[model samples]
Target chain A: MAPSDERHRARMARKQEVVAAKVARASRDKGLLLVLTGIGKGKSSSAFGMIARALGHGMKVGVVQFIKGAFSTGEEAFFRRFPEEVDYRVMGEGFTWVTQDRQRDRQAAEAAWETARAMLQNPELGLVVLDELNIVLKHGYLPLERVLADLSRRTAGQHVVVTGRGARPELIELADTVSEVANVKHAFAQGIRAQKGIEF
Target chain B: MAPSDERHRARMARKQEVVAAKVARASRDKGLLLVLTGIGKGKSSSAFGMIARALGHGMKVGVVQFIKGAFSTGEEAFFRRFPEEVDYRVMGEGFTWVTQDRQRDRQAAEAAWETARAMLQNPELGLVVLDELNIVLKHGYLPLERVLADLSRRTAGQHVVVTGRGARPELIELADTVSEVANVKHAFAQGIRAQKGIEF
Candidate 1:
């Protein structure tokens, strides 16, 4: 096609996209499951977005923080404002090394899993954010089969997200979608420190 | 508490977390919007496990998923990956019924404020997952304030995840972590039936 023709096609395509967006917006479907794996960061950050997003819409939200425990971060503080808006929980007992207790970690995992299981069973729950659970299974902290079964049996409309490094092939296989983060580079390696709000 | 009591408590805590799987993973601190927004099914699933937990390990993660994107479906996907993870964007699209105009859904506010801008400005974007962005800001179709500015100013250390109903956000987001999927939800939802692997 001539350049003018190509330009016209592009313009038309743009218009069509605009219309499509409108249609999609008007035709929203049920929520989804997102699995974040690989060697990159931002998995939890993305999940938090969903948690906040769900609450913003006046939808009930529940968060299970597997590794961070119940410590208050900027996000937890923000989420706290809407105590009624979101049913959130910090599952982990701080950092693994800080705790320096294997048994404690296992207990934390089990406790968190219990909450996760309960939330999963609730039919009305719209979105469930399971942060850093891959490691829980990878380390055998939680029964993989049980987690898989629960996830498979979750409410039809509920959306679930699972994040962590070394995501098991079984989990990936079972997951509706899988993402592997391949690390290209990092700033900490260059002797840079983390900043607040941005890195907290 | 007394130091001796604290010591005893710490020891007990350590014993509890024992046997909990612990793996050392590396993450990056880039300052760009690493979006995973598309018309795919697993944006949040992928974001939660990897990004959030990474943040928990002293890494920073930011997330933003458009539409009534919040809610806890009872999955440990994102927050489990915290510390290394923080920052979030929930589109608050709330279901399609509220966001009647795909082209001008409520995220128009998000798009206008440029929540992505603040996230992009951070130099420690170990991961920036723009969960569900494609549907939210396709062609700047919605309010085009912040999303545009952030997309334009994003640096390299940040990662973004965007997931949800559509794919236009992908055009400008320029995802380093891009994966688009056509979901196959439960067959029963489609009326025929609900299978385990293909549908779940």
Candidate 2:
């Protein structure tokens, strides 16, 4: 039957009622712990997008990059345009594969974690983005327990977003929202270079 | 074993060589057809992030929103700040559940697609974001064949991003890159409201 049919209209009416009830019941307000993971793109990009959203809503934001930063990215240049609203830091020496020294990678991650911990404790920062921190935790550069403790100790209304592949199960368990970005297809696999303004 | 060990050093050397060769092979550059879908948050958020990136790289962007115009979103507000750099449109009556009118939705989606088609043909637009287009396609609000035809007819150097849940198989096949954002846990499930700046 067409959507204009009585049966379809009736079904939709019933569905709407149920949905409205559910929406009405969701009344609580609290800080969100979000994990963006899986071996695909958009993990960090989404977090940065949230930073833009928070800023639009008059929220101060902080960012600490843990395992990127070999080269400057488009986000760094753009967000830097709003220095007063965005506290952006690119602390990673580079990826572990590029650094090739566990000790150096550990030092970079530890320093990045110090900044992240401080941001987590800050109530004034409406949102804190720990970009690529998952890779640091996966490589054991920082203690997962310590990271989790710091996340838990955050101010009640300060949102936190952690992004990268290979998210820890413990972190996922504690997160209020978890999104796994699955790589269905990739341009790189098709011999297309990761171009500027798209991949970054 | 420590990364400074001979074996680890040798392994890193071999891996780096292979990665460098792969990077060298990816010499071709072309327009990208990206699909961001699946039932989770950040699909539109990531697309907005790419919009930011394109703007940062001095690229003019066009955005056509198909099914999300009931309320004002943070992305729309932020991007509006850069009106000269962005062409943003919101052409939806609302979600199907909210509007409860099929004829109106079809008219709105068709109108939105007309704008999207023009953007695809315009080579000057470096990036075009079809926000929530997948949902429109899924709902059969617009003709699938016409949509695909317009996509394939896009300018050689223009990038296009389509975001929403339940991507069509034909669209996915045409997409150079496809990401499925899986919802593992959502705060709404725990009675937490989808707050402003984060969920919008």
Write the residue-wise lDDT of candidate 1 on B56-84 in tens digits. Answer: 34567666655443244332232433333
DockQ, prediction 1: 0.09
**Candidate 2 lDDT score relative to the true structure:** 0.87
lDDT of 1 at A183: 43
Best by lDDT: 2
Off by over 4 Å in 2: A1-5, B1-7
**Model 1: share of native contacts present?**
0.04
What TM-score against the true chain A does chain A of each candidate get? 0.82, 0.95
Lowest-sum lDDT 10-residue window in model 1 chain A: A190-199
Best by DockQ: 2
- Quote the positional error of residue A175 for candidate 1 in Å: 1.8
DockQ for the candidate 2 complex? 0.69
